[model samples]
Target: MYCYPPHPVRGHPCDNISGNYGTWQANAIQREVVVVGGGAAGLSAARTLIRNGVKNIALLEAQDYLGGRVKTHRQDGILTEDGAEWIHGGSANRLYGLARRMGVLSPRVPDSSYAWSAKTETGRNADPAGYDAAETLYEICERNSVLSQYSDFGYGKCYADKFSGEYRRNRGRRSERAAWLHFLEMWVNKDTGLDDWRDQSARDADHFTDWGLDQWDQWRAGYDALVAHLKKDIPAGTISMSSPVCKIFWDQGDKGQVLVVTQSGVSYLADHALITASVGHLKERQDSLFEPALPRAYRDALAVTELGLADKVQLGWRSSWWGEPHYNLNIIFTNDIQGEKSWLKGIMEFLTIHNQSNMLQAFVPGEYARKMEALPEETVKRHLLSFLADVTGKSIPEPSFFRRTQWQKNVWMRGSYNSYVTVEGGNTIMRSRQPLAQAVEKNGKPVLLWAGEHTHTTRYGTVDGAMDTGEREAYKIIDYMDATFG
Candidate 1:
């Protein structure tokens, strides 16, 4: 079986595609507002401003392509998400809501009918009780009410205490408990995209706001459909692709305006500059990117919050080799396994995708993610294939297609997924991101506004969170045409 036929290849839209490769030229272009970074937050902010009658908006993206972390990769007939796969919620989710109205959603797979199996790295069937224990722990973590009880705790403490208590109270076999407990440790690292959960604030998990929609799926065309839809209403040539904003001289101009300079020396003069770059990118470039430098409070906020890496290794075949309609093979690593391929410890499951039939993937998050990303493609495929064969004890057929994501290495993205609230990276200040979300002021009016997932208070690290921040910033400009910046 295969997935849907390939859609026509597209160049996305409004891409003034040129990079820093050729002869450099410097020029200044003026506009009402300048949007830096063409990811979800930037595109959302641009569209909202335009619709609210704020025309002459210029969106400058560093990379040649848009969609930032919402990127979708397609090769031959195989389609895989290089970044985000789930919309995370249904109708109330801003992106999912737009996809709903646009009727661009892909058909949902009957995942409930799928098959699941667990085995040790030594090719022995793992005790199902361990799998059961891990599954129960996953369910408990999903309950916001339960997580809230640990509001003052770190994720490491809360989940660990919970996992230990649950199995002890249930009177489960110690051997079975130990098996999944090892799996659970790796699972937490991957799920949170952090090397150690002690750094993860339990308060952050309790802060998540869920939209009450059952469907969490992908688009019919691909994730870029959302990007295209956001760009459709904004004027053509509004976006300058391959244009990375190197310096933002927010309060430098004599005309009480701002100057945003790209890497190629193209300056965009505008009344206000809406910055929607990822926190990772901002963290990396903050010192030099800002003219007068980000305020001390914002710098402190950046220090306390951390961005995590979550990389994927995907394989596609002509037909289903696993046989089951929805097959999930979970590998539970034992204590004895060690050596050169220890990085393989990060991968725990081989699960099928929702709408695609020919593909299966494993995510490598936390500490090993960067190490795995640095390996050569052939090396990765050979090791991953061997790992699969060892755990399954089956003569696994070679996949026709293989891919892995390197979000950490990608210059623009810096890391995969979103920000995590650190327990003690700096002073907690009650775990508030308010300073990071606040706008920079000039002459008692807003000149440099921030928009991105990191800005949302309750919904950090989600697509909806990013959308909310973008719209929130756009509305701020609309509401306060002239006012004090907070």
Candidate 2:
């Protein structure tokens, strides 16, 4: 569904409306706060706001459904994920706590060896992994970030320290160096979607604070449950779905009110509006327009920020032949025959399949993730067949069902959340979380605030990080309001 132009009728400036005499009195409604985007960040922000004694908050989401990217679709008793599947950094993740509290099924790592497969140049399986070989491959990947770097962004930057001779004394055979590099390149490409590892700054590489590669937890009942449970505390009708925010007009110069316009041609006026949409969503002019415009510092910070893509393609099998009692999954490599190279490919080369009984899933990230969204179904099926053939000795029958979700193409969420650090093509810590006060000075009082994953300093990109940021921003707003009005 295309959300088109949002024609806002010109009216009294917010400062005039917000004053005891003008716009503030005219447009100033009594809602505690207005939060844009009802995803993890938005929900967490609202919850925090209410807990902090702020009630009558309104949440606006572009999609009819609430859960932004953490949705589940159950078909024929098989559960399929159209958005988020795995929970990274289980220990510190607040979502994990919520999952357990809400009684949702938690995902655990299967304690067994995974299957491996080989494929042809045109993306056809050619080799199968013997029991020990797959284990050995897993060991190699476990010890080295090279595989992750290669799988994620195809930049091979994850292993920059190792590749740059940091581990020269412990290097493997010279003849195999080329092969290993090639394999790593494939991993990086699939993981991050960049052609050159150098395209990313080394500092950006270090930005991922919640790095849990060894173990990943999946939400069995569907990750969306958290979204629903969080929504329950919020009063009905507080959330307005299918409402894409067009522009935000903040009169920080005189009054402290923030006005938000929706694509459906509706206008909302409130004391404050907290933005929690995706970073990529900010790339749009419609998404960024603010009354009196944003400060140059905030503008520069937003301009420098980079958005990464993470996408998923889920396929369902009739039977659970892929799972073994020992290890419930395998990451079969069907490509990477050549040495390190970078480019987006049509074929599903780098794949990690999750064997969760009725459902099997493969993740395609970075640039290829963008390409997969446009690929033909038959071609995609062929690629999966080839991958399965290489990993498992037997050719499991064609999957009874197939479904995929593309974050890059999704309107509400332009791309998946990927973390980044300061040194690499990112804004400084000061710029990231600049308070609304810093954005503007109103009657000697600062106004016009900003928050989201992009505004977070310590933890950014993860759902937990988003929540932490939302809560932090809410308190900042409350503090600002009290300090000013009191």
Candidate 3:
């Protein structure tokens, strides 16, 4: 089970404890709280607030739908996820726990086969012995806490300089070396959502806590079920869909209420406001989103943190092409000289969707993912079919249906997820995850608080992290209300 560290509630110096605390009034109409963005964090925050007797709250979602990065699509009676597909951890994961309760949790089969490709020809099978040696090296790194020891280097640097040497010595074959390196590259890219592992902070990557499970688990019924579960307790009329917040007006005067204005000129005033926008969106609009502007510290944090793109292409065929697969095919394109700079580089892996015989989903990450999102639908489909045929060494048929996720182009979510980047001679990770609690009033009242996956140090870039931040901010607000308004 995953354990959360205790987050201390910050002292609100702006709250007037002595005289007429609860009766203090401002010019604008008052609300208990206003939550911006209706993703996992926002929904969780709203739920937490309502459960704790904070009813006078407003939740705003820019999109018509509730789930942010956890979108699910159904085509031709087949359910496939457009966003997050797996629960990274075991029972300790909050989303996993929710899935179990909802009876949507399913054990993801640990079945994968890799194929190697050279400049001239593609191999039918990958070097199993070489792959095992690479796995052994990875195990050694994990067991000895190699990344923690080498905090100065990035994941790519550490692997290339240290671990790669060990693997090369064990394997010794040039073909095997290329295959292993390509596999590692694909693995790290998919895991971190970064274009290259060199961009990933080794220390930050090692800091994540997991359930010690090797295999991944999925929500069979789709992530929308989990979103619906979260929304179950939230009161109706509290959530306002399609209400994009334009600007947040705060820090007006002593005891002044925070004003949240929508794009359509509708405004709501609240004692406190929680900004649950994605780090990508925050990075793009932080300067203009706030009326008084954000603090330098917050801006610096945003600058240091990294948001990456990850996209999925789901193809549904009329019939299953690969006859009763003994094991799942995980195609890794190694040296495709013909299509090095195209969508082929971004094609990390293709897997047959669990329980869906005729469906295949391609995992695309990094800069290539953004590029894939820009290409024409037919262009992507044609390239994917040609690439798959080359890797499998068989003629592949066209899919009846095709769907791709455009997270990079999504206005609400400029990128798929967040990852920490190394900043020289400073605590960049902590700064990046630090809650935005700048005192908006003389009495130490924080009118603005930030929550999202990016705001979590250990669990950033996951649904669990988003939910945790939401609950954490909600508790902080609850504590502040109890202390000040009680």
> Which structure among the candidates has the greatest TM-score?
1
Q: Candidate 3 lDDT, tens digit per residue, 270-381?
A: 8889989887777776655676866666665666666777788877778877665322455444465454336667664566787776777767888788888888888888
Tens-digit lDDT string for candidate 1 (157-191): 66677776777766666766666676786677776
Clashing residue pair totals per candidate (backbone < 3 A): 0, 33, 6
Error of 1 at 282 (Å): 0.9
Misplaced by over 4 Å in model 2 are: 1-30, 105-107, 111-179, 185-196, 286-288, 321-355, 390-396, 419-447
lDDT of 1 at 396: 74
TM-score of each: 0.89, 0.76, 0.87
lDDT of 1 at 81: 86
Give one digit per residue, the lDDT tens place, for model 2 in 1-486. Answer: 223225322331221221222443355445657888887778887887787777878888877887665677777766767666667766667677777677775657553354434444433433322223322443344333534444333223445434424223344444334434444444554444443444544444434454465567777667777787777778777888877776677773346667676664456677778887776666444334566656665554555455666566666666656454222232423345331112123233333334354556655666566666677667666666665565455676887877766777776666775533223333243323343124354564334445566566645656666777777777877787678777
lDDT of candidate 2 at residue 79, scale 0 to 100? 72
Q: What's model 2's TM-score?
A: 0.76
Which segments of model 3 are wrong by more than 4 Å?
Answer: 1-29, 112-124, 137-144, 169-172, 325-327, 332-341, 423-432, 435-442
